[model samples]
Target chain A: MKRKEQKTFIAAFLLPPLLLYALFVLWPAVNAFRYSLTRWDGLGSATWVGLYNFRNILARSSEFMPALEHNVFLMVVPGIITLSLALFFAYVIHQRIRGARLFRIAFFFPNIISSVAVALLWVLIYSASDVGLLNNLLRLINPKHEMIAFAESSRLLWALVPMIVWSGTGFYMVLFLAAMENIPDSFYEAARLDGAGSFALFRKVTLPLMWDVLTTGIIFLVIGGLKIFDVIWVMENGRPTTTTHTMATLMYSKVFEEYNIGYGTAIAVLLFILVLLATMVSFRLLRRERLEY
Target chain B: MQRMLGGAGSGLKYAILVLYLLAVVFPMVWVLYTSAKSTQEIYQNPFGLPAAVTAPSAKTLETPIENFEKAWVGSHFSSYFVNSVKLVSISLVLILLLGAMAAYVLARFEFRGKGLVYYLFLSGLLIPMQLILIPLFFQFSDMGEALTRLLGPITERLGLGYLTVSLHDSHPGLILIYVAASLPFTVFVLTSFFRTLPGELREAAMIDGASEYRIFFSVMMPLGKPGLVTVAIFNFLGLWNEYLFGLVFLNSDHLKTLPLGLASISMQAQYKSDFGLLFAGLVIAMVPTLLVYMFLQERLTKGITVGALKG
Candidate 1:
């Protein structure tokens, strides 16, 4: 009876937070799931479309598969490069080398920036004109080939690629850096004396141990990759045949701009499921007993 | 021989680090330079330094005077700014105070459905903002309309002219969204900070007859300064650059925040590129964040690493 009463007592204190959170977040979350089932605009009756909304995106829309391919391509190449760079930078800094604090701050500053702002900056950088940063730099060095950063569709892809990679490397660096610091130094010291060189030491020790954090980073990048709407949305606003379009931007264009609520919700719901599945998989596979060493 | 190679390798490593740093920092410097230059000169020489800061000098600056002045004076940018500051400040303070208090209750005291409550908050961290935006907008609209209707009847009953409460464009409306979006991470972050506090510290305070409120306000609040600073800065930047919600919520031209304001006014000529005004506006819009970052440079790193990584 005492235990039950104590539980009730604690429940009273926890009530307010739970109520507010559910009312705002959980309620909306239910609405998101529900709305995905219905064909609704910003107004009017939501028709019960059943599995059609899901089916439309999965099997119907022409942009669906190509955009998925683009998002997946975005996820793998830049994702792997940035994660490895972050891990490397973190490892170096965690070694307590000189100017570690400064390096960390310089790297992590980009995380605070809005993706819209970064997109704006990178647009200028990749401008097809000679005023663009990369083309000018290229002109300055070689003065040959007049590299078209944003002229051709393929060129635009290559142009925006650097911005995506450049902006995100710092965020993952901070994550891995933290994980590295949490690893016991005694293990590192012992590994050092065992005649393990830098790459060998990292491969055997750091990567295996920080696997949990790495998986977490990968999952984050995957979801983040799929949700690549805002930056792309700001730059060109899903323009020129929608070649650069991802699922997120496609949803936005169809729904808000084109007023295709049914199709947009269909895409948004697909992204949510795909992201959710990726996160669940990462969590399931990567979790292990906490090896506190 | 291996030692010699290791020495060369370390030297190469330094070279790579310097190259990486230059790559990141160079574009930022270009922004600073471009912000000072005139449009005429930008076309002729993209790489030249600014001859003057403001005009009427040896060299002229060539952005539209109207845009910068418009941002500062014409538009209620000052008012919109205050709205943003007040919204962020009030929301963060409330979240920190209430969040830390609730975190204390969860961490120190025995609680029912605690794990469930914890996961309830944790699940929020996974939810990206794009998903729930539609439902939230509907809720906000409904609440706003309901408040307006209530205010109308009350005013009429008193025989006064009806002054409808337009909660839609009000400061409180923005604050509501900010709080909802920010509370999850703030709670997660402060909970960790709270758990690190020694249990005896609070218990001993309790023996001294300190109330829960007092223990929280007096003891826990002050010690959690670092964590508070971290959360505060993150909240500041997040709210500052937040456009999607701001775009949806704020409709009046006079009520526009910096980001939306810049986005609307800066681009012209039927999409004719005005890199000059755009860069100037971008620089101006980016200033508060840059300044905040420069100040919280070290603390921000520690906070994000600790706050975000554990999840």
Candidate 2:
């Protein structure tokens, strides 16, 4: 192709997507910074409030602070359980135990469903009435046992622990399993030849070789934990209070529901910063020298 | 003694895996059963199977299928399902075409500001899209009027009356947002995929006087089918299940997607003792994705691993 034609072709190819992306994505992203500085409801004129939104957000008593705390709690509490269980399952599956394929598929089934649907499933499972599985089980175990309102906003975060872990563990397990599959069988053979027990072999051979993917998995968990909204939103029936709010939920309710455009944009900005910082910190904290085979 | 110990260890591993599997599937099984039961039956025997013969009446016997029918027709999930299908299909096509074109350019060309453009696309992956939610809403609100004004004259000249296009609370509005949000990751993946394809074929096509567009469409895109399919499936699954964008942009009842529709029913069911309908709605919402995942498990899993493990 001639130079002019080639340039035209390139422009033809790149311009459409780049234009749409910039208009919808990049422009709004940049505009979010400006929106953060103004106190405006979405419908009305935005005023120059400077840093007041940020100030209120950072104050101890603001809903944003507690929301952040909930996010952090989710990050730490579920993070550890999810990673550990995922690694365990991945390792077990790697061992080629009987029915491993069935377990893998069964576990991953939930990951394929919509987050909203998953939340609804959990809402049923935790329903305070007779339809609740947990409550029914409780009633069976003790005839007079009162049904627990597990889906209520006050208990919503704790209720999320199982739902998050259940839906999440399988993906990470499969990720690590894929990475494990790539590790040459000779390495495990060598470890066994060296008299390494199964536990010792895993710790020595499996974990080190799978470290890179595991780090990626952890980073994914962190990002996902911070961005959690749909589950909480659906579970709380789209009315999450401060106790159950994560950053994403808070941003949604504030801006969309309350029309606090400036405050919500400020939350969005902080959420972006938090996700970036968390990703960076996770990479830094989990960084290890690459193990070349 | 060593054999016994190994047997015990294996037993323990099996137990854990089985326990986890049961934990994973029990909720789905329970919901499925509950969807088949009446509210009275559910309250009376939450764990029991739906009665083999309910009141010996043909009308009330098939509560299982009836609940699903109610959810599909009565709760209006059928429209939501259609809406989700439309949104996902349109967005996936646009995302693939635009993403492939952009990825093809980035992979093959050495243009001015090439690195800058590539990084600009990559940066979209890191910035949590929730950050732009408010601005996005504002932009859509602004564009609603702007588009109407821009198109009004043309429509008037064409004798079609005033043409109005609102980006808020419309299908196209949500489609634009979904395509944009999914673009960064799609581009990043497809670029790397395109780079991996052998350059000899493209060079061969080039030497034969094929135009750049021809080479891209005929030589490259067909060759990049696997990558395109992977990206397509990933985008389909993500955009199909997307909640936030739809929640914010879709205000009308008819435009609600499956997740939104299901959410509304569940919320209403919280007050009303309509767990059967809620369970049925959950099934309606879940079945398509579930079936797709079951059939295309390898591709879906590959798509996920590629995004995460490729660094």
Candidate 3:
């Protein structure tokens, strides 16, 4: 192909997608910063408020702080539960247990459904009414037992612990399993011959080899935890109180519901920074020299 | 030959796997059954059959699909279902076409600023959509109004009605955002995929006097089917289940997607004793995904692992 022709082809191929991406994603991302700085309600023109919005959100108000705390709790709690369960399941499945394929498929079932559906399913289970599955089970176990209002705003975060873990473990399990599969059979064989027990072989060989993938999984968990909205949004019936609000939900409700565009974008800006920092910090804290076989 | 792990260890493994599997699947199964039950039966026999045993041999049974009927026809999930299908399919097509075009270029050519442009797309993978949501709404609406003004005369002449392109609260607008949001990951996956294909195929096609466009459409695309399918399935499922963008950008009731519709139904279920209807809605929202997973389980798992592992 001629040099000029090649250039034109590249230009033609790249321009449309890049243009759409910039207009929708990149440009708006930059605009998020500008909007965060102004006092606009997303309608009439706004005055520049400088750092007032950020200061008010980060310092002045108790609301944003509690929301941030909830986000952190969500990140740490579900992150621990999901990763541990995923790692354990991945290891056991890696053992080629009976019906391992069926187990793998079943474990990943929740990942196939939408987040909203998962939340709704859990809500039904946790409902305090006669139709509620958990409540019904409790009622059957003991006649004196009362139905728990598990879906209330105050208790929603605790409720979300199991919901998030249940849906998330399979994806990470598949992730770690894929990584584990890449380790040579010779390594495991060598370890076994050296009298390394099952746990020892996993610890000595599997863990180090799969560190990169595990880091990626952790990063995925952290980012996902921080941005969580749908589960809390649906489970709370789209009316998140202070007790249940995460940063993403708070940002959405503030901007769209309250029309506080500036304040909401401020939350967005903080969320962006927080995700970046958490990802970076996780990578740093988990970093080790890679071991090659 | 299998090495002998103790029977105790094997039993423990089976026990753990079965336990977790039950924990995972029981909710969905329970919801399926509950969706079939009448409201009264739901209250009386929460975990039992949908029929009441009035005598030793005779039982009264309610139609299992009553809840589905109520949620679909009565509650208007049918319309929302159509809207979701429209949005997801249109977005899937655009993402694949545009994503393939860009991925092909990035994989095959050496151009100035290629590295920078590649990283630009890569950076998008990390940036949260939450940051862009506020500005995106306003921008789309403004663009819609501008397009309406620009195309007003032509559209009127063409009998396309007041043909304006205001994307806000419309199918096209939602599709545009979905395509953009999915592009980064799609491009990343496909570019790596394209690079792995031997260049000799393109060289062979060039010797036959095939134009670049022909090369792309006929040769490259066919060769890249697995990668394309993987990316397409991932994007399709993601867009189908997407709630945040649809919830915020679309305001009209009829324009809402399944996730948004299900959410609205859930909120309304708070005051209404429509748990059966809600369960039916859950099952409706879930069927397509479950069906896709059942048939394409390999592709779905492989697609996810491909993207995550590559990252």
Candidate 4:
């Protein structure tokens, strides 16, 4: 193909997507930015408020700060925990042990199930009364003093943490496992011949090599942690005085419950900005080229 | 003594692994078990197995199947199912085709505004669905009007008004929206794999007088199966659990997908507190996604490992 022909072909190839993307994605994002500046109930012409929407959310709304805290909590805590557990288990399975495939499948099963289902299941296990599975089990073992309502308490984090780890660790594990699996066999064999034991091999060869994959997993978890909506949405809808409210859930509440579209959009806009900043930082920190074997 | 301690530590690792797996798997197991039990049995002793090998007897099982039957027989899941499958399938195909083509252009060619073109795609990477969703809804709702103002006049003259297209609330609406929503990850993943392909092969094909379209279809696409299948399965699963978009875009009960349908039922049953029926609905909603994961775990793993970077 000549240069002009190649240019023509490229333009033809790109035009449809570019056009659709502009109409659907870029245009709408622009609309959302405009919406963030206005007070629009679904029924009316939106009233322009400029930055009042941002001001009120930053200052007044009861849901805003708690939700921001939960998102940041998710960012700092489960974000790290999930990645660590995923890497550890991926390393374990990468040891070429028997039933490694089973472990991989078992761990990944939770990510496949909807958060609504997982939250509901944990609601059963963490039920507040003797009727719940955990309480019932506790009764059998210890004749417990009191049944705990895990989802409804301030200490809901304890309950939420397990589910967060359970559901997420698997998906990330598969990435690390895939990366670890792709590690040439020669690397391990060389380490073994050098009299390095399993722990030494992991600390030196495995950890360093899987760094890019591990970093990728952390980046995913950080951004996912920030915008987590459904899991919290499903699990009591940020109940118990908004203790479990993530940034996304708080945004939902402001829009749906309080009928504050402007405030909600502001929250949404802030979340979009936060996600962008975090991803960029993670990329900069983690973008070293993967060392080829 | 040291060896025994080491053996014990190894044993502890297995125990921990088994326990974690059990913790996650048990809830799914318990829900299925209870679905076979009567409503009274659930409240009476959920931890225990059925007193006998019981079925969905009133004494043993509890399902809103009767309620669902009323909804479906009156409203019909057939339309909902057809609508859902049509929406998901059409959108999946569109994303795969356009995304792969665009990715090939980006990956293979060096051109003016390359960085801008690439960032335009990359910008979609960090965008939260909810962030862009509200505006996309406004745009799509007025999509027909927008088209008319832009190209609809020309198409009007061309008599392709016979092909008047607005995929909103209808099956095609769901398809169009999903295609747009899923485009970024698909483009990103396809580009990653596309970049890995040897450009020399395409050049050699060019020397043989093969058209770009022919090279794309006959060569690039065939060899890009891993990336293509990866995106297809992913777009399928992502669209499947999709609740917010389905809820907002498709307004009719008859056209609601299983996730949306279950959500509608559960929301109504909220005050009734019908835990048994709700669990059953949750179980029902989960089965299709679970089956996909079971069958296509490899594809899912591949897709997400690439999509993970978009994070």
Candidate 5:
């Protein structure tokens, strides 16, 4: 192809996606920041507030603080359990345990289901009705057991832990397992030859080699916890109270429901900043001398 | 004594593993079996085998069919299923083609502003969808008005009826977003993938008088199959299960996707105490992705592993 033709081809191939992305993704993202600085109902002309929305969100006893607390709770509580369980499962399955394939396949089944479906499945499990699985079990154990509404707004944050852990463990397991598999068998052999037990070998060898992927997994969990919306939306039936709202849900309700576009977009901007800071902070905190195997 | 203790330890390990396996599998099995029962039967016996399975009477056998019929037709799950299929497939095709085109150019060619373009796409990874969502909502409205203004005169002059082009509540509007939003990661992954491909093939094809376009279409894209498959699967799963975008963009019940449909049905079903319809709807929402996962478990896992390591 001629040089000009080559240039034409490049332009032709690149421009479509570039223009689309710029218009849809980049343009809107840039506009989000500008919109954050103004107070406007979505349909009306805007007036500049000059950080008033952010100030309100950052104020003492604001709704943002409790919602932010829920986000942290979601992140930390499930984050710890999911990571620990994933590591354990990855380690065990890596040891060539019996029915390893069955365990791996079955475990990952939940991860493939949509978050809405998973939330509904858990809602059924936690339902306070005769059809509720937990209530039924309780009744079987003791006839006098009163039904408990496990998914009510007040207890919803805590209830999400088991659901999150159940659905998330498999993905991280596969991630850590792949990293574990990449560790040359010779490292484990060397550790064993030096009188290290299985536990010691795992602690010293396997853990160190997979540390980078583990850090990546942690970042994923944090970001996922921060951006959690679908499950909460479904479980709350689209009316998440202040108690159950994460930043994402709050932003949605603020903009779409209450028409608080400025406040909502401000929350979105804060969320973007939070996600950015979380990713960077995680990298900084988890950064170690990269061990090249 | 030590050996005996080890045996007990391994026994306990197996026990734990088995317990977890049950925990994971049992709920899915429960949903499956419970869908076969009527709502009344479900309330009476949430855990037992449905009479459809245990007794297989002519009258009892109709329950599963009725549940599915209610979900599929009585509710709007059929339209939702079709809508999901149409939207996801169209979005996936466009994402793959456009992503591959841009990725191919960025990967193989050396040009000015290449770094700038690459970094532009890379910057998108940091911008969460939440940030863009509100603006996009308004942008769609603005764009709709702008297009209406642009097209109104032309249509009026051509003796056609007055025309207004609105992207709101349409599949094309959402497709544009899905494709555009998906391009960043698609290009990032495929750029590296294309970089790893042997340059000799391109040279050989060029020496044989093939054009750049021909080389790309014939030689590069074919060899890019594995990478394409990986990207395809990831994007397929993401777009298929996407909810937030659908929730914002689509409002009509008939236009709603599987996730949206499932969510709405779940709320209504719970309120109406129609557990059978909810269970059946859940199955409809779940079965396709479950089938895909079952078939492509190895590739799916490998894709995530590669993506994690790379990220």
Candidate 6:
């Protein structure tokens, strides 16, 4: 091919995707910053209030504070449980336990279900009515037991812990399992010869070996926790209360429902900043001396 | 003493694993059987077998069929399913083709600003979609008005009716966002994938007098199947279950995708206390991806591992 023709080919190949990406993604992203600084209802002429929205969000009485706290709770509570369970499962499965494949496949089932569907499934499970699974089980144990409204907004955050762990543990297990499988059996044998117990062997041999993937998994969990929306939205019936709102849900309601476009976009901006900082901080904290086999 | 301790530990491990397995699998099983019962029957025997299974009668057997019927047609889950299929399929095709083209050029070809262009796409990995959501909502309105202005005179001159172009509340609008939003990860993954392919194949094809386009179409694309499949599955899952974008962009009842439709139905079901329809709807929303996962579990796991490790 001629040099000119090669240039033409490259132009043709790259331009469409680049153009589309810039138009829809990059352009809006830049505009989000500009929108954040102004007061606009999304329909009328806008007034630039320059950081007032940010100030409002940062106020002690602002809804954003509680929402941020909920995000943290979701992140820390479920995040810790999911990681521990995944690591345990991955290590056991890595040891070639019976039905490892079945466990891996079945545990991953909930992860593939749509979050809305998962939330609905859990709603049925948590219902206070006669059809509620958990309540029914409680009734089985004690016929006089009162039903609990597990999906109610006041209790929704705690209710979400099991659901998040249930859905998330599988993916991390598979991730850590893949990393564990990459470690040669020779490493385990060497550790065993050194008189390392099973627990010690896993600690010394497996965890450090899969540190990079573990870091990746933590980052995924943090970002997922920060951006939780669908399940909360579905569970709260699309009207998440101040008690139950995450940053993403709050942003949605502020903008779409209340037409506080500037304030909502500002929340989104702060959410982005939170995600960026969380990723960086996790990377920094989780960065150990990379262990190689 | 040591051996007995080890035995207890192993038993505990099995117990925990089995318990978790039941916890995960039982809810789904419950949903399945619960869907086969009427709302009244469900209240009576939440944990028991539906009458259809325990003691089948003509009327009892109709319960399962009727639930599915009410969900699939009455609640418009069938429409939602079809919309999801159409939207996801079209977006997948465009994402693959465009992603491959850009990734191929960036990976195989040496050009000025190559690093800059590649990094620009990579930067998208850090962008939260929420940051762009608000601006894009308004931008669509602006774009629609501008497009209508541009085409209004031309259409008028051509004797066509007055033309209006809107990106809101339409499938095309959502498809555009899905394709564009998906590209960053797609390009990042496929670029690395393309680089690993033998360069000699492209050179060999070129020596045979094939044009660049022909080489890409005939030689490169066929070889890119494994990479394409991985990208396709990842994007398919992401876009298929995508909720936030669909919720914002698609408002019309008929135009809503599965997740949106499922969400709306769930709210209504709660209000109506219609557990059967909700369970049936949940099954409708879940079964396709579940079926696909059954067939492609290995590939799907491999894809996630590779993506996680690489990204």
The candidate maximizing lDDT is 6
Top candidate, metric DockQ: 3
Which residue ranges in model 1 land beyond 4 Å of their true spot? Answer: A1-16, A95-101, A144-156, A238-241, A287-290, B1-5, B53-83, B163-170, B269-272
iRMSD values, candidates in order: 2.9, 1.9, 1.1, 2.9, 2.1, 1.9
> Lowest-lDDT window of 10 residues in candidate 5 chain B?
B1-10
Alpha-carbon deviation at A216 in model 2, angstroms: 0.9
**iRMS, model 5 (angstroms):** 2.1
Candidate 3 lDDT tens digits, B243-296: 999887888998888999899998887588877788889989999889989999
Supply the global lDDT for candidate 1. Answer: 0.72
Q: Cα deviation in Å at residue B290, candidate 5? A: 1.4
Point out where model 6 deviates above 4 Å. Answer: B1-6
True contacts kept of each: 0.33, 0.83, 0.85, 0.48, 0.80, 0.85
Q: Is candidate 2 or candidate 6 better by lDDT?
A: 6
Candidate 5 collision pairs: none
When only chain A is evaluated, what TM-score does every model earn? 0.87, 0.96, 0.97, 0.88, 0.98, 0.98
lDDT of each: 0.72, 0.86, 0.87, 0.74, 0.91, 0.92
Q: What lDDT score goes with residue A194 in model 3? A: 92
Native contacts kept (model 4): 0.48
**What docking grade does candidate 4 earn?**
acceptable
Query: What are the models' TM-scores?
Result: 0.89, 0.97, 0.96, 0.86, 0.98, 0.98
Evaluated at residue B252, the lDDT of candidate 5 is 89
Give the local distance difference test score of model 4.
0.74
Q: Which CAPRI quality tier does the interface of model 6 achieve?
A: medium
lDDT of 4 by residue, A22-126 (tens): 667777777778889999875568899999988888888676887788777876787778887887788767765557788888888888776656766677678
lDDT of 2 by residue, B170-197 (tens): 8988888888888898899999999999
Tens digits of per-residue lDDT for model 1, B207-292 = 99886667777998898888787777667677777777776678887777776665564434116555665666666766777787
Model 2 agreement with the true structure over A61-144: per-residue lDDT tens digits: 568878888988887788899889888888888777667788888887787788998888888889888888999888988999
The window of 10 residues in a row where model 2 chain B has the poorest summed lDDT is B1-10
Please give the lDDT score at residue B115 for candidate 5: 98
Q: After superposition, how far is residue A217 of candidate 3 from its true place, in Å?
A: 0.7
